[model samples]
Target: MRIHKRDKARRRMLALLLAGVLAVTGASVLTVAAFAGQRQPPAQPAATRMGTVACGDVGSLLDQVPAAAQPAVDRDLADLDVQVADAYRSLMAPGAGGGEQRVMDALVAKRTTTLRNLKASAGPDAGLPGDLTGLASCGIRRDLVVDASARDYAPDAQAGSSGSSGPSGPAALSKGSGNRGSGLGRGFVDIRTVSPNVAKPARTGSATGTFTSQCGRNENRHLNPDNVIVAPGVSNGAHHMHDYVGNLITDAFSANNRLARAGTTCSNGDQSAYYWPVLRLLNGVTEKDAKAPGGGQDSNVGRILQPADVQITYNSAAGNKVQPMTRFLRIITGDAKALTNGPANAHASWSCTGFENRQLADKYPICPNGSRVVRTLKFPDCWDGKNIDSANHRTHTAFSQANGSCPKNFRAIPQLVERVAYDVPTGVRFAVDSFPEQLHNPVTDHGDFINVMNRNLLDQMVSCINEGRRCG
Candidate 1:
């Protein structure tokens, strides 16, 4: 009976040992499953996922993954991280959806395709941990900000003028007005009446009879009941006014007459008249002969001129060079206050120094003989006949004469004034005193006339270039 009891005890001990071993094995299996599940969490929120994915933390996460699944898991996590980063960057990037956006999107798409192919080949078991995905999210945000900033601070693009001042600011004298006394004053001599004879006869007689023979010897005498001649009678040549001054006088007279008829005083005199025609010309009224309707001439005349067609000519003994002028135009079709400043008043002075430096480098690389030439002319220097210097230099000179100064700089060139003459059959001739204080030399304290002219020329050239016209 004792032997039987020992056998039973031994069997009982064996059973208890087996139960302990089974319990340990079950716990081990549960632990492994839990670790495996946690390592490969489902896609989480971008912010939270990235926070958990520390760099170089993949090894610890992979410890729970089976040996065979390890490679697949790693590849999947890497791809997911890359895709998440790419997605975030795309949405946050500046100008992301505009024209530039497409370029970046293409790059992201190519990378995504590559990653997707890698994941497909690696299989589903090869997935990345949540931490890796989170890191990718962080990287995406960083890249997006960097790309956006780069695009935002890029260089200023050359955009055509957006309602900025441009050539065609003011109206110019019309071509038709060349002969007619249209804008102001007693209209110029009738071309029909004055063309046949250069001079008007003192007394009314047969067309061929001499004035002295037809009338009494007295300088001022009545030849017949109907005819009287004044000594030094008006001649077509004398009556004709072609120069700018003459045209100005005629315009002033016309303006004054209109004002008088309207019961208003045209008290502004020659200055007012001179500018009036210019303003009219700029308004695209090419026919100087066409009168403003209803005698509203003076009121219409005072409006600011905007030049559409500008002609700039330089004439000297050497030859003549002319450039089509363009005014910096500001359209005032919508509002009358737009007419306040004329082209002359609104001109901007380009820096002479900058122009000189650029031009010299471009054109005068070598002297006429191909020898290297050194640039001696400096900024603020004016032509003083024999030398170029800032001091003791003359400013304004006639187009025919250089005031003894060499043409080393653009400021020294003379601008000629052309006006329509009423006395002459042909329309235009030169004018006296068309040269204003603005055109005179600095010694005379006449303001910077040369600078003004140069600026005007440069502005015209720039406008032409902008308009896609050949400046040459």
Candidate 2:
């Protein structure tokens, strides 16, 4: 009977994890007693009212916890609410905008304090830390501040609407044969300006290759079930959905051995997987499920309308002597702190397909008669020459220099660039889906990759980079 009860508790915890609530594993052992006296609650009723609820007004958020554990979790969450609210008030002050750096620092400190207190408050048997920490990382809090500060915040509606002319890129050319030769707008973020256009480096013993676009064979490769973005052990914890292209099959459950056997869309047979959150066009038909798919989990704005094709590109760093990346290697580019991380931390660029010249900050590009919309993602090239993964998901790799050279003790690898083009027709505007707390800021857009190639396939990619041969 005791064993059966234990099994029941384990199943319950797993269900919660899948539902995007309980994120930690090894939690069932702690939940049995807490849940033994409590009756399982009924499924949540469909929401009758739909509107953005401030983090403080999330009354239903705590209803999912086991009755026995609710008091402790609620107490800590309430305390955290107060701290976050106070910090938001301070940062939103009219003149306080200039002190963003200071605001972020203060919020992080406060988050640490809240985490510590929550940990202390959660009794050993409560199993609350992972869930609490997952939903309230300093990064998450920063997004909240950004959203709270914005006036008339509406991500879903914004995502589906059409865009206005921005400062960067070409004067908006539509897609057609005649649109050729038009360049992107000046001062709008363009890799053609920053990255070298050389086919190969002049340095001795160096080579270069450019693999053209490969149509997306799969969008499931990097749908990380054990994403570090949320609590550890939480399947599909990222809350946001991602579109992956390259490795044929990958998910939170994928393993090196499995990926080694899997085929790739890259002509070189490189099975390295890359992905980022999918952008959604909010065309009235989609519901505004802020924390979509599952409430109190993703908290993102908008619904996803799949794109026709996702383009994948693999190539060497523009001007660097890049070494082959080791199998299973992983790293994070862009600012983990996101929008709060500042200008130097930004690595994302956006422009219209033909009008790639004009760039706008935080707004989607409006294309002209013959153009499409495009998002360009550039990965870091510098590797630590060791350690496949890091605790923070970064630190194992660094960015290359402006001249396309690796930093000391780091080797350059093929720079992964992805161009996702949308087929939205004229008069329709779309925005990248973001956390509701981000207030539709483009600065928070980022991508993630994991090298899952086996030894033989990985070796082949190395040869392509080193020998200056373009494959596929």
Best by TM-score: 2
What ranges in model 2 sit over 4 Å off? 1-114, 117-206, 212-232, 253-258, 261-269, 287-291, 294-303, 357-361
Which stretches of model 1 miss by more than 4 angstroms?
1-187, 191-277, 280-308, 317-396, 399-471
Instruction: Give lDDT per model, in order.
Output: 0.21, 0.46
In angstroms, the error of model 1 at 59 is: 93
Q: Which one wins on lDDT?
A: 2
What TM-score would candidate 1 get against the native? 0.17
lDDT of 2: 0.46
Candidate 2, 1-472: lDDT as tens digits: 0000113443454333323322212311111111113322221111211111122112212212333443444455545544544454454445554444354355545655665665554444333335443334332121122223223233222221112122332222111222123321111232232222113334444567555545463544333323332122244444446666667676654666776788777655667666676665544445344433321133333455455556665666654455667877765554322332223334665666655554433335546666666776777777777766432244456777757677677787877777667765554434554443333445556677777655765566567766777766
